[model samples]
Target: MPAALRITLTTQEHQTLKELEVAECVPRRTKQRATALRLNAKGGKVKAIADYLGWAQSTVRQTIHRWNHHGLAGLWEAKGRGRKPSWTSQDWEALEQWLQEPRSISSRQLSQRWAKQRQVFVGAEQVRRILKKKWRWKRFRKKPPVPKNPELKAAKKRDLQTLKLWAQEDLITLLYLDESGCCSESPLYYGYSPIGQQKSISQRSRKGRRVNIMGVWEQDNRFEYTLKVGTYNANSYLRFMEWQAQKAMKRLFETGKPTVIIHSGRFNPSCQGS
Candidate 1:
């Protein structure tokens, strides 16, 4: 009959294995192997060590053989035992710092930065996983800063809903007007030019004059007006609104429907708006 496996350890080897238990830097497999070796060195049977450590007998034997051959280095797992990590904990720490910085960065851009800084090629998906799983980072879209008036925004939404309901009831026609203004610094458009012919730079220059224009956005038709006011004021805006309301009422009167003019301060005679 084959004799039972007998493993023994020296004093230095025993101390090193004990230290591995408290060592946080050692890998999990290394710690487990160290514990197994420690148990075996104290006259513990191979089967007992394996059962105590919840490891296979073959694993315990392999660890013993490795320790007998390589000593301290044997405590570590062999190379290529598992998948290689493209990034280390230090890389993840740097990534977390970057994420904490108040700036917008996309996953693709972050991967590029990682590749450049770490001098290692990493895929966006892999980086994304590292950020999500390792760092628990969340994805969010950046939006332009608007009013913080959520209540006002909610009110506007309710008003829009009411308008939609009114439209369904034929209460009033919805003429969504999109007003705009162009100044000498703003490009309204290029003047009329022959087809396939480019106009001169002087003619296309927006510095020539300033103009304000508005278009009624409704149905398949639109009424656009161009006005030139050096500085738009309340009077110019009121005139524009009055003109639009006149046109709207004219159409409503033809249809025998009451005219309800819903106007707010939205006209700019001068370079303010169009």
Candidate 2:
């Protein structure tokens, strides 16, 4: 068994609690908490206080402890305390904007971004809980845009069917190619830059120096890449394809398996220039 806790109160504190216990205007829960604390202060045991107030023993002990720790303010409910709100209206608005499509940033990324933006620390789980409970945000697959021309749409469906046949026959291995680049003055930077802090990535501005990367990936854990400076062009794309082909062939030859490389990417009249 543990020693019984004895709460000692000052003359003013005892009197204040006594008044609150019977005050009609005070909320019922507040009165109960006040009475519980008062009984404890008068040298009542935890069980005695709980029985007298019709509250749990744990509740009685917690009430007295809160009163001691926070004085009068602790006796009353504090705004935004306990359990916590999902998020403020402002936070919800910011979240909506952050989750706008084509930017496939995950919940973890948004949580980290918000912490940096707000200068307050929070976890990814917290972000997920709010999104799920409040907004009911769920994963939705992004589908490719349908072509307005019926002929083009049907042609794509036919090509897809042919590719499915090839896949079933093991005649081709589908590999996806993607490329991207970044440069300063991109104007997409978001942050909570503190005052008097240097923000530039480099000591001096290198605004026009562009970086280019091309990657090839497929199922079965096969992948390769080409990275260089300058713009993505027809020559650059062809060279990347050739490099990936040689690597893929050498690997497959060692394994005594042969596969035809089938590249996947959109061909647009507009990208007649990427």
Candidate 3:
């Protein structure tokens, strides 16, 4: 038989190991206890303990040496050994403060400010991640500008009130009319797609087709007006309005004094009294 490697531990060290085993505060304490027992009581060498436990010989020796020197505290691993944080708490606080500012800022602008103010260089993607994840921010695109005309708004409101009053008195008349432009060349609707299926090529075509649609709608049914002109201008729209009014009058003459409501485009003067 090969000679056995002798292992030794002082009485004080053995007593401390016993206390640590009893405490069992840290993770892997049982393993540490078994190692200590094999070393102190069973006279198992470092190599033997390592072989039995399937750990490195240096690991076994270090565990025993740590318990001998620093007692229980040495067995616990040090903080921040696995992976370092991308940004510190202070950096996060600074970023939040910057985001809370009233002025609208782009990602690139924020990145530049971060470098100057925090003295830390970070990419736009990192800044975006911090903003979205940490701050729960969302991106918004501004809406298209609407034509502002206070006079027109006031006139429309007045017209609506007048129509409502006529309606209550049983003198109200309503006609629904609208014109829509249709095109064969559809507008591109941009949106996100999964990574692998993303399209890389674009389609190009110079000549496309288009058609215009015009119609009138009422509570009961719809009256589709002729395409009239290729493009419906204010003149063509006025003509459509005349046609709808004449049709309504003829129906009212035959059906008696029934109330009529006219819904027409802004450019149509059909609502105006003759």
Ordered list by lDDT, greatest first: 1, 2, 3
Model 1 quality (TM-score): 0.35
Off by over 4 Å in 2: 1-148, 187-207, 248-274
Once fitted onto the true fold, the runs of candidate 1 whose alpha carbons sit more than 4 angstroms away are 86-94, 99-274
Query: Tens digits of per-residue lDDT for model 1 on 1-274?
Result: 4366666767886787899987755677889988887877778888898899888888888888888789889887667888788778888777667665544456687789888898657888877655553343333333323434789868977987888677678776766654555675634222222233333322222234455555555445455564654444566666867887787779777875554433333432353453
Candidate 3: which stretches are off by over 4 Å? Answer: 1-146, 188-209, 220-224, 255-274
How high is the CA lDDT of each candidate model?
0.65, 0.64, 0.58
Q: What is the lDDT of residue 173 in candidate 2?
A: 61
- Candidate 3 has which clashing residue pairs, if any? 173-260, 173-261, 174-260, 174-261, 174-262, 175-261, 175-262, 175-263
Ranking by TM-score: 1, 3, 2
The clash count for each model shown is: 3, 0, 8
lDDT digits (tens) for residues 216-259 of candidate 3: 76545556567742556566666866787787788789766554
Residue pairs clashing in model 2 are: none
Scored by lDDT, model 1 comes in at 0.65
**Could you tell me the TM-score of candidate 2?**
0.32
